[model samples]
Target: MADDRKVALDAALKKIEKNFGKGSIMKLGEKADQKISTIPSGSLALDVA
Candidate 1:
C-alpha cells in the first residue's frame, strides 16, 4: 500500500512538473507564501454547529 501511494505521488509530481515546468513545486510554494502573507493573521474561523 505504501509503495503504491509513493508511486502515485511521484507520478502526480512528474505530471505537475511537466505541465508547470521544472521547479514548479518551489514556484507554487512561493506563490502560496505571497498569498498567505496578504491574509490578515488570526482571520481564519471555523464554526461547528
Candidate 2:
C-alpha cells in the first residue's frame, strides 16, 4: 500500500541519516573521490546496490 511504502521509506531515511551522523571519514573507492561537508554522520554519499 502507499501508506506502508511511505512508512518504510521514512524508516529507511532514518537509518541512512543515523549512519551518516557517525562522522567517520572514509576514503573513496578507486572510481570515486569526492567530498561532502556533512551527511546524516557515517553513511555512504551514494546509493549502493
Candidate 3:
C-alpha cells in the first residue's frame, strides 16, 4: 500500500537523478525556502513551465 508507493517514488527519484544528474529533483519539504536559489533557463516559457 503506502510502503509500495514510497518504494516506487524513491526508485523514480533515483532514476531522475541518474538521467538528469544529482540535485535535479527535490522531495516535499526537502528544500528550505530560505535556501532556495533560482536561475533563468534562457526561455521564459521553459522557466515558467
Winning candidate number (lDDT): 3
TM-score of each: 0.51, 0.42, 0.59
Q: Number of clashing residue pairs in every model?
A: 0, 10, 0
Q: Write the per-residue lDDT of candidate 3 for residues 14-42, one digit (tens) a residue.
A: 99999998778887778633565799999
Model 1: ten consecutive residues of lowest lDDT = 28-37
Q: Write down the RMSD of all candidates, one decimal each.
A: 8.1, 13.5, 6.5
Q: Cα lDDT of model 3 overall?
A: 0.87
Compared with the true structure, what per-residue lDDT tens digits does model 2 show for residues 1-49? 9999989986776777688853333325534345756545455655331
In terms of lDDT, the poorest run of 10 residues in model 3 is 28-37
Q: What C-alpha lDDT values do all the predictions have?
A: 0.67, 0.59, 0.87
Q: Candidates 1 and 3: which is better by TM-score?
A: 3
Instruction: Name the regions of candidate 1 deviating beyond 4 angstroms.
Output: 26-49
- In terms of TM-score, the best-performing candidate is 3
Query: What's the candidate order when arranged by decreasing lDDT?
Result: 3, 1, 2
* lDDT at position 8, candidate 3: 97
